[model samples]
Target: MIAEYADRVWRGESDDSIVDQGMEGKGVKPIVDGVGWWSGFGNVVAFEGSGELALFDTSSPFSAAQLHADVRAWSSAPLTAAFYSHGHIDHVFGTGPFEESRRATIYAHEAVAARFERYVLTSGYNAVINQRQFQAPGLRWPVEYRHPDVTYRDSLTVRQAGVTFDLFHAKGETDDATVAYVPEHRLLLPGDLFIWVTPNCGNPQKVQRYPREWVHALHRMAALDAEIMLPSHGAPIFGRDRIRQALLETAEWLESLVTQTLDLLNAGARLDEIVHTVTPPEHLADRPYLRARYDEPEFVVRNLWRLYGGWYDGNPANLKPAPDAVLATAVADLAGGAARLADAALDALSRGDERLAGHLAEMAALAAPTDAGVHRVRAQVFSTRAANEQSLMAKGVFTWVSSESSAHANRLGAPE
Candidate 1:
């Protein structure tokens, strides 16, 4: 059943919802002779070794118990060690459950420890941003983390039960990412490196993503020529040719963005101009792995600009701009009133100019902070914008903004 589902997903016949079904503890199914894969929001791949089991990832806190139970069901052998793909909350939380029987030595990139430290330092901020990002108001950031016991800088090779596991470090979605290769099995565990979506190099609410470094990592993985690939978030890929095409094409997609962005930046173009101009390679648009369902290419362009050029955005007036409210009030007065601005916003929305509508609606609300009528229009503008977007990142942010205005509209009784 999983194989058929995986094939459908690979062919782009299945939607993202199928991949995001939220971990029913699908149980550990055999990948090869001795390896077992437990599919979840965060997949855990267990390797049966000399009277013990080694895991690729431990999964999130929510799925910890189920992950343990499912893996235990597959194998009674105790977990001897585990490899963390990265320090993301989802991939590092399940070890505690397994540690009850016997503590498993964890191995990861050295930067994973620093990532945990930063998570602790910004726990509250992380919680709030994540709540907005995922639309989970009740979401709480985990203060506690399972730090890796063994850390490596570049690469580490571990031989357990006659199986060789080679770990390599790279920066992509996170600063601390580990890509593992098992030679005997001819398997590649890419972690989130190849999540079957457009590389998430442009998360608006999160930290910096290394597109250039990520491209390098993808290229490196492609060169490995692994026959079977198991990603942290998506279905496994079979055959060397299929795996090679996915990895290399993904690398090309990111490299296209990086090259285009750098060309514009080197040409002394403003970020606004560069963002509007730099485009993903047209040839690769139809590739199933290159779709921008989770993170769009435009966001990646913005992230590249921020990486090379500072936050100035090449707009002189924006460098020391007036407060948003102050600017909005001036514009509102020029347009006659805040109601006029709100009307213009609605007109923009009706014309299918959501980008313009968003700007006008925001200015209208800022100009008349207490006007429920303006807030009503603002709500409609953002909700419509949210509906039009494809990527979850844009949808989440737009939906959150709409909800904010919606609360005001409800509280003030909507101008009636």
Candidate 2:
């Protein structure tokens, strides 16, 4: 898979250079005595002499057959147990591979069970729309949800192979998030709570996230005095002080969002106004860990609104809506033909007005996807804008759009 990813990059077939660089030659390495986030998506913690192994968060991409092959490269320790930090598909779906190797008991929060059940019921609906959300083809939600054999509500302590593993449940990026702490090793495995780049408590295209609760969860994890913090995504933090600083900063960032949202709501400001006004502090904004790579602050505010209020975004016009295509056609007709709108969008791009250019270019793409000139202009504009974007959320969205435009241009036989 890594080779295939590299080949795609070399062939100029994909724009995932960052991901490719991160994964290149980065096979699993042991942390402390036994803990490791394997070459794949999960982590493994083994007991030194007992050959006892505990796995955390099995990932997809590789089926059971493939995972078995990969696991052999690591230790041949007998799998004792599997712990799911959350009910997310990436964290649990690959457990089938481990289950086949040994009779591993699965442990997770009780809420994880409910989450799995919900996924089973809504898998079809989730599969259909997931591609659009992540801009990936064949992104399907798994229907086969393996329930946890052991479930806990708040906390659970398990001692195996002379090492004590502490599991603490807290609602963070996911409703069923669990943080595993090994006091003996001073290692903290905080699933998605600290996903390296950002907390991901505000995924714009996904389900609701609990930002306030995530902030509280981070604070709690920071207070644990753990020396090493390993996250579900990205690299690990080794020092106690560094881990504490990261967690504290992330909490402060989320707290700022929560406080700003409440202040605006109390001031009777509308949703759009609040979103425009409430900017995260510069210190938080400058931090690499807090970058909005996957989720933005606006989405966090929206999630808070859903948690405190309801689905309605306090906008009466958005309470109900006509079919999107019908409304889009009407809007296109009002702005004249899509080509004319696209020409105007090009003019906006020329005038260094990216905000307006982005809006118009999007409209042009939706309105006249077949137009070669529209696709070219949209690609160029979005690419330039993406290069200048500071926020990862904006960068990802724009880069995806740019890629889409380039794909369309290729389909139309336009020159690169």
Candidate 3:
């Protein structure tokens, strides 16, 4: 039987799509009796107690204030505990509003501490990665993080007014991933584990992700027969059968991708070959919840190769390859000049051959960064490529290239 009060959730194709089109400071929706979640750039899962409350995650800094205000509308109780699903800045940075005092204990897997440390060391690197990955050249990665008060190695449980939350750790998108289960409600809250998209276990620009362990985590949740499932990024799912099926099928999708990719890796296949080879089962790929809207199966394969192999991609030339400028200069010289290559890029874009267009465009830019005509064509082609892409990572990178090209052109035209 389906839960009649299941949470009404928001499912966005991409984070920018939701953020720009606006879902910020969105109000809470009911999941069960005392459980609900607020939709923003990310979701905050809230559970109300008689005189206290708990929240699974706080959305990013951009919308955390609004999300906190919205959650307060439903529960005026001071937060007794806040759970960090993982160390992602978006999930862990917004607890300041709920910290009525230092008395509030925070829970997370112990692995998060090391992840936080690494993030601190790589703050500038992360900032640049985010700018290129999200197309926001001005954005900065938040350095401040709220460390956990109580951490578990594997799993932990807490009870408040007879409501039991069993928090389990399993690696999916990150090593410190946590999946929460409430026995009384038969509801599951696994932050990014069960987003209603092809699982993002294979982000191209991030650290290693655990697809095999992630599948096992899904299996563990499916075994519980949850009546409702809520993810930090996507809409809530209802009904015991539907929930179980969703969880298991999501597992199947990962298993298929992992198995296929691993076989290729073990066979000594190169990263490029594996990327083009590994494929998820057609049945699992067709599901609405598993669509590759933000991250594709192809990218997942590349990540798998990284986990098992090194960055070499089995190509000796890439071990210490020539700089992009050096290579682009040669290509442009062969093509006659930067202007000719730029025209070829535009022609490729017009013919809808974005892969070829992207190559020619980059060569034109690297060969003649000061040429306004080359910059104009490069910007136009990349902008078009960005619009045509489905995955957020691809779109953001493409848009950044276009934006950079456009800014260069504007800079060249300005009066000295």
Candidate 4:
């Protein structure tokens, strides 16, 4: 099943871009006069005449400086206005370049403004933790966050340069999200609402997401019958029917996950049991637009747990857990020792048992990160496992572990 999906995704049948074209420095492509779509780390929709541009979301693994450079190449159109679909750093931090523009009016939902203020207050804590979440360097809270100059509760319309852009608030992936629609152009800019990648409604590292509200947002967008759909990330989609189908299917997918998880929860099922029993609809399982390339259904279940219930997962042991390393060391000792676990992992790898090998190797690495042989075996096992993973989300995480293991091995003078 994974292979079949990979074939479809790789055949260009799906909208997935394995390599981000924008990150490769591809200049912005023109969509309309003064108006164009910049595909890089994120999608930037620009209207040049008024020297106005609205960036959807900030792209990952790229800094605000790079995004600014990409926009500069497209139009010296002075940044007139900017909008954040949500409060995520990727959508908001890149506005530094636009902030310098004296005339730029930043727009966002009222919740977004509150999120920014929270980030400012907890900048140091976020900086330390976000690094682990994204596995990127320079994880520092953006001190100079550019707050939205214009914030609305429900909806608002901004007319500039003979273009009318309507902003609607939707509490989906984030509580404060704005979906911009250009009635004249039939273009809908849904920040994270409609990324080509899997809807991150259930990010394991983040806060609660409103799945029911998210589905409503998609239904609303579908009703708009927009001709062109510009997502916060990935390529621009054309055609009203195609756009509507994608939106509706994505919403259905989220709704299914929510309903199924809720059913399991009401049955008094445990979290693990709920995750294992709940499956997304088979049709959506292969739909390119609904693929679990980033966030998985299990995480969605957890998100649902948070939404209906509080943070507690009803698991007493996990309510206030000890440090990860402390638990890992105890587990390693139960398995005899870190070396015994490493040997077991090697055996699992030799038997082509990636799942078992991954488990054992992770324990060994965590228990003894400096062990040369352990790191060597871990790098080899994880690298091969990552190559075989189909989902981009799984592949990225495994790849991060593999690269980290290889670097650790080199540092320990392990044999290549």
- Which ranges of candidate 3 are over 4 A from the true structure? 1-26, 414-416
Error of 4 at 71 (Å): 5.0
Best by lDDT: 1
User: Lowest lDDT 10-mer window, candidate 2?
Assistant: 15-24
lDDT of candidate 3 vs native?
0.81
Q: Give the number of colliding residue pairs in candidate 3.
A: 0
- Model 4: how far residue 211 lies from native, Å: 2.5
lDDT of predicted model 4: 0.75
- In model 2, what are the clashing residue pairs, if there are any? none
Per-residue alpha-carbon lDDT of candidate 2 for residues 300-327, written as tens digits (9 for 90 to 100): 8877777776776667767897655566
| Weakest ten-residue segment in model 4 by summed lDDT | 1-10
Supply candidate 2's per-residue lDDT for 351: 95
| Winner of 3 and 4 under lDDT | 3
Better of 1 and 2 by lDDT: 1
| Better model by lDDT: candidate 1 vs candidate 4 | 1
Query: Where's the lowest-lDDT run of ten residues in candidate 3?
Result: 1-10
TM-score each candidate: 0.97, 0.83, 0.91, 0.83
What is the lDDT, from 0 to 100, of the residue 169 in candidate 3? 92
Q: After superposition, how far is residue 242 of candidate 1 from its true place, in Å?
A: 0.5
lDDT of each: 0.88, 0.72, 0.81, 0.75
Sorted on lDDT, best first, the list reads 1, 3, 4, 2
Residue-level lDDT of model 1, residues 51-119, one tens digit each, is: 878999888998998998888888888888999999988899998878986888899999998889999
